[model samples]
Target: MKILVVDDEPDVRTLFEQRFRREIRSGEFSFSFAYSGEEALTFLTGHHSEVVLILSDINMPGMSGLELLRHVKHDLIPPPPPLVMMITAYGDTDSYNQAMELGANDFLTKPVDFTALKDKLHAISTA
Candidate 1:
């Protein structure tokens, strides 16, 4: 499976890489990273057919994840939209509700727990 990971922080990218290295190296999954929402859109435009999922940070500099989510749901053409899961430091009720209303497949808090994330991924993938 191909996954797009969008986050501004280098450390977050590194951590994701580390957490999923086994899958990546073993050919179970592949990932591409974008530093901003614009970059994510660019990647999607080119790799729309390949990408099956997106893990996005909610508090980006130029375009927030919610904005990205809206664009993914409303603006993209062909190949259908990939499943998007919003990750945020602000894990409040309002944010979670908004994310779901905006069409998020799932919501995860910052300092992401890999086991929980993996389980969610597994469930989503199987479905």
Candidate 2:
């Protein structure tokens, strides 16, 4: 599956690359990283069809992930939209509620549990 990861932290790219190295090498999953919501949207504009899932952090520098989520859930599509999972360090109820309202498929808190994340990814891929 092709997945887009959006976060402001540059290190997130490396972290995801390292954590999912085995899956990446096995060709089970391919990732595209964007350091901000705007970048993610730009990438999606040209490659929406290629993406199956999006993992986005809620607190970004420019366009917040919630805004991005609203756009993805409402604006893009040929029918079935890509699944979006919101990530955050806060894990606050307000953010979680907002994300859900915006049509997020899942919610994950940081420091992400790679083991659990892998399982979720496997489930999505298999399903």
Candidate 3:
């Protein structure tokens, strides 16, 4: 499975790489990183079909994750729309509701629980 992780934090790339090393090495999963929502949108413009899932941070400098989600769910028309999961340090009701309304498949609190994320991924793959 191919997943795009969008976050402003540089360390998130290293953390995801380390946590999913086994899956990556075994060819079970592949990942791409985008530092901002605009960057992720640019990547999706060309590679949307290749991406199966998106893990995005809700708060960003410009074009927030909810905006991205809206664009992905409304503008990008793939045969099957890629699943989007929102992650945020501020796990508040407003953010969660907004994300869901924007068509986010899941919402996760930071610091992310790799175990839960892995299980969700596995379930998605199997389904």
Candidate 4:
């Protein structure tokens, strides 16, 4: 599966790499990283068809993840938008509600639980 991970944090790329090293090496998954919402949009515009899912951080400096979710779920043309999962460090009610209203496939809290994430991904993949 091809996944695009959008976050402003530079270390996120390294962290995801470490966390999913086995899947990467085994050819079960391929990942692409975008440092900002804008970058993620650009990447999506160019390669949305190949991306099966998007993992995005909700709070960002510019063009927050919610905005990006809007674009992905509502703006960018044609049918069949990629499944988007929102991640936030703040476990608040408003953000969660907003994300769901914006059409997030799932929402997760930060310091992401890799085990649960893996399970969710597996379930999504099979579905």
TM-scores for every predicted model: 0.94, 0.97, 0.96, 0.97
Sorted on lDDT, best first, the list reads: 2, 4, 3, 1
lDDT tens digits by residue: candidate 4, 1-127? 9999999999999998998899899877899999899999999999989999999999999999999999999988665899999999998999999999999999999999999998888787777
Q: Which stretches of candidate 4 lie over 4 Å from their true place?
A: none
Clashing residue pairs in candidate 1 (N, C-alpha, C atoms within 3 angstroms): none
Error of 3 at 108 (Å): 0.2
Count residue pairs with overlapping backbones in model 1. Answer: 0
Whole-model Cα lDDT of every candidate shown, in order: 0.90, 0.94, 0.93, 0.93
Where is model 3 poorest over a 10-residue stretch in terms of lDDT? 72-81
Write the residue-wise lDDT of candidate 1 on 22-71 in tens digits: 87788877889999999999999998889999999999999999999999
lDDT winner among the candidates?
2
Alpha-carbon RMSD, candidate 1: 1.1
Give a tens-digit lDDT track for model 3, residues 20-123: 99999988889999999999989998999999999999999998998999989998866567999999999999999999998999999998999999999989
* lDDT value, candidate 1, whole model: 0.90
Write down the worst ten-residue block by lDDT for model 4. 118-127
